[model samples]
Target: MPSVNPPRGMRDLLPADKARRERVLATIRERYRAHGFDEIETPVMEDYVRLHAGIGGDNEKLSFSVLKRGLDAEAIAAAADDPARLADLGLRYDLTVPLARFYASHRAELPTVFRSIQIAPVWRAERPQKGRYRQFVQCDIDIIGDPSARAEAELLAATLDAVDALGLEGAVVRINDRRLLDWMLGHFGFSADERPGVLITIDKLDKIGVDGVVAELRERGVTPTAVDAFDAFLHRPQTLELRAFGEGSIRKALPEDAPDDVVADLVALGDAVGRARGIPAPYFTLPVQFDPFLVRGMGYYTGTIFELAHPSVDYSLGGGGRYDGMIGRFLGQDVPAVGFSIGFERIVDLLDAEADAAAEAIVLVHDRDLPPADLVSLKAALVAQGTRVRLEQRTKNLKALLERAAADGYTSFATVTAGQTAADLEVKPLS
Candidate 1:
């Protein structure tokens, strides 16, 4: 027989594992609910066209594709070399793209401004690193059809609360705007068409250092002057906090197309997020700050872009931004949207590191020959009194039973005595 093991990048969640995750998940859902985001669920598989509609960016290559069936099967087989043509459906890589398609398909039935909560597993066909996996859950909360900066402010504030709930200190969300980024690129001599590709390169700054980025940019044919100016900006020493960068020396270099009012907008956004009330009043330490070079990997972001990064690890705990033009791409009508997604797996890893693994459990050892009705009644009574119960058949060997319960994370045990009824139950601690 083959070994009973999960796939390379997946694993089973035991009972205690589930408890810890559920605890964190409950906190996140409560935060989302308090922010007025209603829950929504989309399918695991979406049409292959949805992945290629230009929203996924680098993620499209990582899609787990499903082959064609029914009507398209013949054409797919005829053109076997091109795998994309042979696939009609693919598993979703992220929730945002599918959400856009969902809204387009079911707009009439939804509210004018749809605030959605989608917590589900997404698949990718990429290399599995420390926190990256082939299958992982992503928690998304989006406010669609709202064009104001308040949407960004509220999303950041709510995410800060979620991060705080996860017990992460000094978790700050870095803020920037794609519009301002473009103006900066244009200021440094990049043409209209070069900005998008350049922004993608900029997004890789954290992964590849400035030298690596410059090398890649030069390989992509970026001019030397543009690269030099970008390098200078990256290496310049300055505090990333709002007050520091809000009045830094770099603030004086705004081009004609890039309005200087962006600073005012940043100040207002920071204030709005700071003022926005959370269930836990001060949800963040250094809440929202500025990262002039921060560009999220997704191509759909159009306006404000923000990311919440892990202090120890070089990955975002969560991130989201305005994708105003994405829905319009699907519906043929412009609809503004802003959203945020908490990286569920990353947070889970953080929690797991601190998890004790031996959370409280109670095991009920009943007689081997006990009637099923008696066991059921006893368990129900215990549960009704707000007790956690796990029933097992009582064997002659006391040591075996105790060892089994301990291995299963049970810290206490209970049993029925004397008469065969559940009412004559006794409880005792395992330790």
Candidate 2:
């Protein structure tokens, strides 16, 4: 007989894992709702063109394409041979893309400066690893149509609040603007075309050290002086300070008539949000800075771009930014937008570690000894009382069941003992 197992990059979320994920998700949803964001749903599969629009560089490579098996064989074959054609339809790589398509298609139906929360699984074709998977959930919140810095500031505040509400410790939101990065590169002599490669290399700065970034830049044909100048700018103390545009030389170099106006607007917005919400104050300590080198590689971002990072982890928990131009790519008219995504798998990994340290468990006792009605009642009671319960099947022995549950990371267990009745059940916490 073949062993039953989930597909690679996916898993059977045991009860305890489900409980933790639910808890985190509930907290996030609650936070989003409290802030007046409506809930919206989009199809899991989208026309490849819509999904791939405005998504280029590294993210484009990770998209998972889908096709009809029999009905469109010829079309599928043609699409498979051409990247652009393949993107005419595919499973959504992230919620943001679908949301952009949604806004553009249904702008009349949505409110101006519409706020929405979308929590769903997004597909990717990347190789799986620790805390990284090809299929995973993403929690996203976005505001469309409002260009005020207040929206940006409020989103940052809400993100921090949501993470803290999940009871996770040491999560930090690192923010920078794409305009700042663009300005920095230009200031250091990187041409407009060179900016993309430089952005990709610099985005990895935290992963790879300064020398590694410099080396990669050199390999990409950037001058030695440009790399050194860029490095010095990023490391300066002013980079951490929320100085007004007039106070900085880099700020002066920014386009006099940039439409997004990230420098003055986003920084002030971050400051206002910081003053209003003290909880995320430390996380949003400095106003959104202009880090000319903070180029987020996604082609759609037209304004601010920020990332949430776990203080101890090298990878981002998730990130997003304003993409006023994304909707226009699909609808042929500009639609203002900003949003952020939470990396569900990374968050689950962090929560799992915390759960392990706390030694939380749910034990399932064999049901053979108890009458079926009694077992059902007991299970209902435990669940109703906010306890995660597992009911063991009759075929499993007590010792085997307990061992298996323990290995699966359950810190507590509730079993239906032979002598206990449904009306008078005794629930004990496992040591």
Candidate 3:
């Protein structure tokens, strides 16, 4: 027999779960709209070549490709040496790629600086585990064609507000700059060719402490001199303080020789976000920190990088960064782009599902002997008055049926007689 369950890593949300998700999505949409970000959508599939493009970083390997239509056994066998040739398109692994294509296609119709909100499902082929799935939704907000720190500021402010609207408390954003990472690696003598691998190892700093990182770098056979320098810097003794984002704190977190320009840019971003949020001191208002080693895993990230953190979870809630060079690959002209994505599948589990109090929801328990016409009339009358009414035939397990109705979000239930009109019905709260 075929399995009586949804495909692995996919799910079928029942009515109650679906309704709760919709409520959360609605809240997100309203908050983003209020920030002047327009909602947009793109096709779930894109050309296989586009998915394979170097800009996707490691996510390209996980994309689910679709075989070319009408390909027979012989044709498929011929392409065995080059499997990518067998597929013409693939599911999008993230919204950023599709948004880049969309912007390139509709540049003339959009504003010079476009703020877009994309809330949709993206697919990846993966060995799913707790809180991770092969198919899940991503909530992204991106700004295109703006090259100033203000773009980053607006994104940070809007994202924090949306998280607040969802009632996910104590969320903080950890900010960094890709340029700073490169500079730091270079400062420590890591060659240009070795920076990527070195950054990957440093990204594990949170997972593995300083000693583990140094040991791993040595095992990877990186330059002995460079590894020694980096290891020494890591072991340097210093007081760790819980400071917010600012020039002083940022400088303290980095080497004394860290470039002044990048530090200035990050400070300006922090200040702008603070003012936008109407906090007297920007860093004090929100929990933005400067982590010189925060290497976000995307190769296309050109400058600023950030990850969303919460005290309740060991993993990030979501993250994104500046991919200024990505849109240029499609449009043939440089357009600065940056985005932040909320891990919907992860954060949704963190919220407490609360019944919507404003809805007038009811269940009608009608006798089996009642005429169908009478039941229909009663339901239509209640519905016309803007009440959500569900008709349930009275059952021998009447108590069980009412209990189920209450759990399904019905506020009250009423017994309907054949002759009773909507006004004659008496409602009792479900308990």
User: Whole-model Cα lDDT per candidate?
Assistant: 0.78, 0.71, 0.90
List model 2 lDDT by residue over 1-431, tens digit each: 87698777877887657766776788789998988899999999888666655565566678877644453767767767677754446778888888877888888998877998999998888787888777899999999888777778778878877876776777765566776667667768888888887888887876787778888988888767887787665555533444442224334444344334555675476557667565254333432344444556687787788787766787778888888877777788887889988887788677744543332335656555577777777777666766556677755466676666665555566656665644555445554
Residue 16 shift from truth in candidate 3, angstroms = 0.7
Best by lDDT: 3
Candidate 2 Cα lDDT to native: 0.71
Model 3 lDDT on a 0 to 1 scale: 0.90
lDDT accuracy of residue 236 in candidate 1: 68
Query: Which whole-number lDDT from 0 to 100 does residue 26 have in model 1?
Result: 84
Q: Which stretches of candidate 1 lie over 4 Å from their true place?
A: 1-3, 70-77, 235-258, 277-285, 352-361, 395-411, 420-426
Q: Give stretches of model 2 more than 4 Å off.
A: 1-5, 54-56, 68-80, 83-88, 222-261, 279-292, 352-423
**Considering summed lDDT, which 10 consecutive residues are worst modelled in model 2?**
241-250
Residue-wise C-alpha lDDT for candidate 1, range 362-392, written one tens digit per residue: 7888777777877787778777877677888
Instruction: Write down the worst ten-residue block by lDDT for model 1.
Output: 277-286
- TM-score ranking, best first: 3, 1, 2
RMSD of 2: 4.8
lDDT of 3 at 8: 92
- Candidate 1 residue 9 C-alpha distance from true site, Å: 2.2
Model 3 error, position 189 (Å): 0.9
Per-residue lDDT over 331-383 for candidate 3, one digit per residue giving the tens place of the 0 to 100 score: 88889999999998888899866624437799999888999999998899999
